[model samples]
Target: MQGGTTIVLPEHRGHRLGLALKVAHHQALLARFPDVEWIATATADVNAHMNAVNDRLGIRVVERCIELTRPVGRAS
Candidate 1:
């Protein structure tokens, strides 16, 4: 359900391995928790590669969010 800092191994490239892993994990979760109503995930807006995978997996983007940051001495 997440991919923060983990690096994919070189041999796994082009196999859609990430997508396969995510689908399998989600299926397992659903099987274990039948009451669950939703599955959610995110990728950076600029990551066309992941977006393509999401599309193939039928994940609809319901909404988007942005992060804001400020320096320690700066006022919001």
Candidate 2:
């Protein structure tokens, strides 16, 4: 299962709410899908807080993705 973005509003920052939510979601996923093998999720490279939360949950970076864009009518 792929995880969606987890956000805590600015007013609720620094209370570890993101971490707690992720933990709860993971537990529920496991309970509901015992046959599942892996869960995939992504966060921006600069999202240090989310990265830390993922680390705590034993989620390691398997790969990195980069996106590039150019003008629609531009020629290479």
Best by TM-score: 2
lDDT of 1 by residue, 28-76 (tens): 8788888988777877899876788788888898999997887675553
How many clashes show up per model?
Answer: 0, 0
Model 1's TM-score against the true structure: 0.72
lDDT of 1 at 15: 82
lDDT for position 57 in model 1: 82
Estimated TM-score per prediction? 0.72, 0.81
lDDT digits (tens) for residues 1-76 of candidate 2? 6667898998997899999999999889999898889888988899999999999999999999997888666574
Best by lDDT: 2
